[model samples]
Target: MSDHDPRPDASALPWSCEAEQSVLGALLVDNAAYDRAADLLRRQDFFDTRHGDIWDAISRLVLAMKPADVVTVFDALPEAKREEIGGLAYLGQLAACVPSAANLRRYAEIVRERAMQRALMQTADEALEVARGEGSFEEKSDRIGSLFATVRETGQRSKPLFVGDLMAQRVDHYNALAQGTVTPGISTGIPGLDEALGGGMWPGKVIVLAARPGVGKTSLAQQILLHGAEAGHTGLLLSQEMERTELVDRAVANLGSIGYSRLLNGKLSNPEWQRLGPAVDRLAALPFAIDDQAALTLHDIRTKAFAIKGLRLLAIDYVQLCAAPKGAPRNHTRNDVLTEISRGIKALAKDLGLTVLLLSQLNRDVEKRSSPEPTLADLRESGAIEQDADVIAFLWRVREYESHRLIACSLPKNRQAKPGAKLGLDFEGHYQRWRDSAEKVGHTGSVGGSADLGFN
Candidate 1:
């Protein structure tokens, strides 16, 4: 009792921030401190995974973001815990400081936008739950309305075409080309194919080279990859069915004037190795990247493509193997998935302004029919693929198993050129290469021999 006083103050001890919290605690001291803390954390640029996750969530909340589209974003917190978040309150306070719109019409428009988002999500949920079951006419009508509104809003926000911007972009293109910043799109060294492809692969187009199994689709694609890299353009090949080393083996076999099977089986002799070493070195040094990831989705491909700076071309081998994004409508058949994937690939070409080569599989109808040629209808999965692609090439090797190499390519749909034009060729199985046959006739484009391409 000697030291005890009737009135005691508890302010002597330092006030500790909340347990297991950083952002909230900062706001607890001063309601406006959350922004400074978030900004500081962002500037720090935490690279650790654990800290990254926390900071990402905090950063979103600091901006008063609605965590509705992504469900797992804020799923861990309870209502009480969210309420305890002083940072959220601070965000609310900051939001209040913004010039509150005096016009009710503008406010109503903003509210309507949020409502439309909710309505779209609701329609998506219903579509998923029903599993293509027929609903009442009224319910179906409402869902259609919601979908239409979402589509309209999205389309309206898309980039509008302008002549000024178009001209400026072209000027930038010529400038880049003059400065040696441009990379050749399709320098396959086959002058005929190169010319037909419009100075190599044109940007903002998807060219699908489709064939049946056991054909030379993969081989021809790999040839293009090496050629592109050697010509100073970055090329990414996503080979879902083959391994990375196997891809390298194909490239070396094609470039070094050797057999692919010989290289794979380690049957190359000292003399063969001597010839292969320089070719391999040159290929390894080229601006080429390969991902042998199996079962990749469209999104996975997009992520990898996005990393290539000044990317000239992206090739996806065999579309059917690639999966679509999860959580899509359950009623969406494989055709729907294919349509979405093709559209996505086309969008990538438009966004990156690079050529996209999408390898596709032909339907069994090609095998059943006596015509012995693949048509646009033979494209596996979706018709949308044919519609979306700027150029659709059908590859047909009359005798895939026969030793004499012959691969026939026909442009079924070329938006810029005459359609149904055949580009005939001979394939070299040992070197895994394609070339203009001595028998090539009526093709008016340029021509180059395989020997002239340094493949000897």
Candidate 2:
């Protein structure tokens, strides 16, 4: 056998040299074509390095309000680089390659598709290297996950919409609203919250539920998830702080109306036992999934969350526990990592067009105040969390009173409604459930008289 391996065929690599030439030619022929092709193509999308450079130069000239053509581009390039890129003649050749600028958009699409394929090839090569390296299993796995995320992101690239196109979409939305055919947003199962939010959680929004420990942030999130599931929306709850079993226990207690302590201690009475079976069955029937991966990185979460088909909402139970991806700068402070996590979650929500509810711990500063209610400023570690969140609500219950059954929920920041809105919820610690306080009157007179027990 020959010592040398056969070279891969050039044609086998995903690329459209002709399309790249066409796009460049169209831009050179008519600088105005830049506007049409700007959104669809980027300089890096060109397979040919020289073509990418020429495109970059052309873009610079056009964006600067100067004319762009073969001569102008050639003149714009550095003298030392011209000969390396086949001198000025290559520029003239590219301009002559296209018949007209009419199909510039089509050419751009072809270039983008080829670029995406090339990106996948590159990612695959890097992943194979990782697999063959001496890295640990987790390292290799994380590397692969990061590569996959990059591929997914590359596939999602698209041109920005023009003003006319955006206005058209806006008109359609208004018409839908006028016809009473569109549900404004997802409901949180709290009537007061729904009214305050003008519907409920909306797609492409980040809602932060911040509170001190023992104030029921997770409880409130579970309530919202249960409500969403009941409304036929699928949700993924990523719990870094709690085990999946614990989550299920809470859900069971909340749904079964069984005492949380009884479930935890396995001291259930016969009546509670009777309710537990059906409650477990009901919880199993909901379209809610939980991942209790400890110390999950942002990339890990994104990979798993994106895989869930029809995922409408994502809940991160206490974001501070999540780890930044491997290879993050060692010099990054804790606050920097938290900020990155916060922005990453926010971006994920927008990119996926889903709602993200992030539970967060309040700072001790809130406890030092005479009024211990949490505020947006009380978001622990990073101010970016407050800036990135579209809605920030604080969960506050009286700390001094053990018998107070009401939890105070105050919205310090509401993008869709007036801020400083307050709502009271009846907290049933036994069941790990929160209900509108108004619902308490009817339950208080029940034969069991269990609802009268103040558990906060």
Q: Specify the highest-lDDT model's number.
A: 2
lDDT of each: 0.63, 0.81
- The number of clashing residue pairs in each candidate reads 0, 1
Residue pairs in candidate 1 whose N, alpha carbon or C atoms collide under 3 angstroms = none
Per-residue lDDT of model 2, residues 59-84, tens digit only = 99999999998778888888876876
On the 0 to 100 scale, the lDDT of residue 133 in model 2 is 92
TM-score of 1: 0.60
What's the TM-score of each model vs. the native? 0.60, 0.82
Per-residue lDDT of 344-426 in model 1, one digit per residue for the tens? 78987987888888999988897676566677789887899989999888776543333445567778688746667776777
Question: What is the Å distance of residue 216 in model 2 from its true position?
Answer: 1.4
TM-score of 2: 0.82
Which regions of candidate 2 deviate over 4 angstroms? 1-9, 25-31, 53-99, 147-164, 262-278, 399-404, 439-456
